[model samples]
Target: MKTIDQTQQEIVEEFSMFSDWMDKYEYIIDMGKNLEQLPDDFKKDEFLIPGCQSRVWLVPEFRDDKVFFKTDSDAIITKGIACLIVRIFNGRTKEEISKSKLFFIEKIGLVQNLSPTRANGLASMVDKIYRYVK
Candidate 1:
């Protein structure tokens, strides 16, 4: 997986190459397609995230000083968004993660496009991750 800075830069650069919003949307959907599928059991209520329109569940685990996460969502796009967060935060120490800013979502131009509920869900998910880091 790429580092947060690398992923952010890559997404920004990629979007910069697009001539239109249609192309950008296509790229985002493609990115969603590349996310790893979550297991059926991980979608259970114990892991469920409450704010999303789609069902989202996230489980955090720590190993060898690194944080690892498992997540699933009923919506494909949301799942991909969760995957992006996992890629950014996983394998980092709690302090490192807490101190870092998640600017990649903005770099990918997601904040402006997502619905209010979805955007709130994203924020909730990030808050959950930070809570674990603390």
Candidate 2:
């Protein structure tokens, strides 16, 4: 499996291919559309992430010493954001997840391009992931 940094760098390279933010946003929406659906049973309020402009749910499972994540969001862009995150951190070891800096978010200029509320939601998502790691 690719190291977290390798995966992040791959994403950065992919984002660099976009000519503009609108294209990037479209790519993100496409990614979200391709994300595997989280089960209805995992969509409970307890799994809901706080501080999001849209409702986001995260469900984590540990198997064979790796953590796997399932996420869903009410907003397309937010779901896309979750897709990026889940693609990176899911199925990774706790040690790998804990040590990751997730530089791809900034490297892709995703955080800067987001609305303030969405940025907060992103932070909340990161926090929720870390909480699960612990």
Candidate 3:
């Protein structure tokens, strides 16, 4: 299994292959398309993330000192972005996730390229992940 940083680097390289933001968006949308569906039971209000324009449900499981996240979003772009986060941080130890920085977001210019609402939503998604890992 890859470390979180290694997974992030892989994602950055993947995004770097895209020449334009539109292509990157398409890539993200495709990633979202491949995300595993969250069970209807997991999509309850208690798991809902705040400060998002769309409904996002995030659930974390801890087993044998590793954390695994299961998440879903109502919007396609948001789902895609969540898929990226889940891919990076899943199956990591709490120690590994505690001080992690999602540098890929900035390295890929995702923070600047996203609309303010989507960016805030992304931040909220990440914040929730950190909170869960803690």
- Top candidate on TM-score is 2
Quote the positional error of residue 130 for candidate 3 in Å: 1.2
lDDT of 3: 0.84
Q: On a 0 to 100 scale, what is the lDDT of residue 57 in model 3? A: 90
Q: Which candidate is the best by lDDT?
A: 2
List all candidate RMSDs to the true structure: 2.5, 1.8, 2.0
Per-residue alpha-carbon lDDT of model 3 for 1-134, expressed as tens digits? 88888999999999999989999999999988888899999999888988787888988888889888898998888889888888998888888998887788888877752344654477777877788767
Q: Please give the CA lDDT of all the candidate structures.
A: 0.75, 0.85, 0.84
Instruction: Tell me the TM-score of model 1.
Output: 0.82
lDDT of 1 by residue, 7-98 (tens): 66766786789878778777756667776677886767877877777777889888999898987777777777777777778788898888
Which ranges of candidate 2 are over 4 A from the true structure? 113-119
Clashing pairs in 2: none
Model 2's alpha-carbon lDDT is 0.85
Question: What does the lDDT read for residue 34 in candidate 3?
Answer: 89
